[model samples]
Target: MDLAVLRPGELTGADREVWRALQSEARALGAPQLANPFLAPEFTLAVGRCRPGVRIAVVHEGAGPVAYLPFERTALGVGRAIGLGLSDAQGVVHRPGFHWDAQELIRACGLSVLEFDHLVEGQEPFGSRKFPVFGSPVVDVDRGFDAYLRQLRARSSKFVRTTFAKERKLGRDVAPVRFVHDERDPAVLRTLMRWKSAQYRRTGRSDRFAHPWIVRLMEQLFHTRTESFTGLLSVLYAGDRPVAAHFGLRSPSVLACWFPAYDPRFARFSPGLVLHLRMAEAAAADALAYLDLGRGAKDYKNSLKTRELTVHEGMVMRRHPVALGHVARRAPVRALRHAVLARPELSGPADRLLKRVGRLRTGR
Candidate 1:
């Protein structure tokens, strides 16, 4: 196999053509999780332009393109998934017959260790070494939002009823509720960033939007207008008041849920959950198939999801000294995380601990 590494923006001409083709083929694999729009050239290029050092690997056996891998080269010969902290899904996009052999690919990429937090399950070679898989909640709206709601009602009547009831209460108590599935106002995007930043600080998580590149990436994506890949900002407004919003990347059929935050003042209204349902309704109307809520646990995700997709967090490394170091650094954290997540007893305390830390940091 011949492998060529290029900066995400450097993908052009025949390479671009093959990349698009491979992306199309990968999306056609009939799995919503596998059809990650983030892997598309447009996304990688946008991210690469904002964050330097992102490299794309194009692998070919004989003639046509077979697979593509996008990663970032960090110091100490360590590699990470292209948008490690942000990307919801990570893995090679390859055809069914594409060859395996993780070590060969790692050696070719000149990396001793490659780490991924949200690796898409089912990717060959890498799939072999995937850490404990976790459920990523998704709402498959291909059939129709009405059908989806019916299914939800069948599965969890209380959840559906309570959410709709909250939405109604929000409309009555505040101004008549309004949900715009695709909000175009740049000011609204800024609002989301602020809310997200505050939410991050309040939760003891690093504020992603504080990073200028991530902010710029969001701006670029919001302005990015494409049928196959584009930024989608959904907002729930009460009168002129924005209650909750979500900004995500979407292909023609799939929406990768990225940043979502709500005005804490309206927390009682459960605007975020209401926004998700409306988002699902709009996405289905737009001919979209799925809304991947990414990997993580949230009460809303569990309640709103029609099904679950598995994602992995771990590293695939070569037999190098740094590889062991990387493993030692990440594995313990991963083990602790999964352990905490698997048990509510541990998870609750962990969350409380994080919240306490966040309160301290925020001086709250």
Candidate 2:
């Protein structure tokens, strides 16, 4: 096996085709699952376009490209999965039967450590230390929205009823509600960024949009349209007024839900839930199979999920200070996250604390 490192922007036309082909062929253990869009060339390339540290490692067997590994190498030689925080699925996207030593890959990349959360299932050779498997909630809509709603209603009748009633009430209180499957307005994206940032500050979580590179990347993706993957901004409107919105990426079969936010004044109306319902309806119509709500322990996920996908959180590392630094900085945070996810009783206070902090940040 041979490995060739190429800057994402430096890939030639031929290299790109092979990279895309390898990505298209990667499946979870060659199962029937669709190719994860996070691993696609378009995503990594977009990240690279915004972030200079991003690179792609094309793994070759003989003369054929068989795998594409995307990662970020920091100035200190510490590496991580590309777009670690924004990317919901992380892995070495290899073709079937193309496995390699994780440690060797780290050494070859000249990295002291490679860390990741949200590592996709069926990724082998990563580590012996595995974090607790958490469900990334998914709503399968392959059979159509009505059929999907029936499944949701069966699982949580009250949740279904309350959400539907909220949608109806929102429509009545405001104007007749409308959902735009793809809203092309850049202003809407900016609004989402502001709302999402405020949401982060309010929750005491790091606001990813605080980073300029992330902002640039979102803008690029918003304008990017492709057959394999398209950046979709779904906006729910009340009359002519936008009430709730979501910005996500969609492959042919999967919609990767990213950031979703709503006007706080409409919190009572639960417009966010309305937004998701419209997303499901639109996605089903677009022939999408699933809405990946991503890995987390939010109450909304519990109520909305029809199924779950397991994503691992851990790192593969060499014995070095970079690795130790990562372990030191992240272990305690991960411990807190684990506790919050594991114990439902703590979630309320946590949410309240986040809101309080956010209020403080905003001087409210």
Candidate 3:
């Protein structure tokens, strides 16, 4: 097998052909994120505008593409998959049964450590790294909303009944219910941005909406479509005014939940939760298999989750001295994270500290 390193703009016609070939194989193999349009070169270009280190490593076996790893190299030789944190799946796109060693891939990239936060279980090249597992709530939407609601009621009767009762109360007292799917309205996007920014500020976190490139990327993604997936913009309106909105990527089988926001004015009504129920209904009608509410342990995700899947983010460090030193210094931070994960009570202070550190680093 031969390996090649490619920069963002250096991808040639041959590279694109190889990428498409791998994507076709990924689709046939039912490897979800590997086949996603977000992994495409164009999408990566848009993400790279906000995150500049994105790159690709392609592996070939006798003139045929065998695997492709999309990654970003950060300072101090720390490499992570492109769109980490936000992407639900991570790792190389490899043909089935293609068993290249993880260490070999790390060497190929010349990376001291390759870390990922959303690596699909059993697909980690470096084997398992101890990390927290959070339930990613998924609503099976193939049989349509009625069928889904029936299953939900059967499994968790009280939960479903209460949410519905709340939904009714919201509509009756707060506002009239209205849903818009695949909405092309620019104003809806602006509303989402404002709400998301406010939410970040309230939480004392850096607002991703403040990035101009990210804003442009979402706008671009909303209009872009493919045979298997289309970017969806869903909004819940109250008396002709949008109060809750979600922007995400949807294929025929999955809705990869991304940015979701709701007007603070309607916080008492829990517009975000109401919006999710409506999103599920729309997804069911669209014949999706699952609504992938991305990782993180929130009470709402727990309320909606019927099952749990394990994902991880850790790395096998190369033996370079500098890399070892970096790992040693970062080990205490990793340990702190593990401690917080083990004891949820510690999360409040730990999260505040991490946010402060991030702000200090980014000057945000």
All candidates' lDDT scores?
0.85, 0.83, 0.74
lDDT of candidate 2 over 1-364, digit per residue (tens): 4888889877777876775565555443463232667877888899998988997888888877777789999989888899998899888877777678988888878788887887887776886346567689998888999998999888888887998899899888888988899999999989988889888887777888889999999998898788677899999888988889999998777899999999898999888987898899998998877899998877787777888988888878889887899888988998998888678699778878888887888788
Pick by TM-score: 1 or 3, better one: 1
Model 2 stretches astray by more than 4 angstroms: 23-29, 32-34, 345-348
Tell me the spans in candidate 3 whose CA falls farther than 4 Å from its real position: 12-42, 129-134, 348-364
The order by descending TM-score is: 1, 2, 3
In model 2, where is the ten-residue run with the lowest total lDDT?
A: 25-34
| Candidate 1 steric clashes | 0
lDDT by residue (tens digit), candidate 1, 1-364: 5888887767877876676666655656654455677877778888887987789888887776778898998767799998898888888877776766888888888899888888886775775443777788899999999999999999989988999999999989999999898889999999999999999899988888889999999998899876467898999999999999999998877899999999999999889999999999999999888899988888888888888888777788888899998888888887887888899999999899989989999999
Error of 2 at 357 (Å): 2.0
Q: Highest lDDT among the candidates is held by which one? A: 1
Residue-pair clashes per candidate, as listed? 0, 1, 0
TM-score of each: 0.94, 0.93, 0.85
Per-residue CA lDDT of candidate 3, range 224-274, in tens?
A: 776655778999887788888999887656687889999877777777878
Q: Name the better of 1 and 2 by TM-score.
A: 1
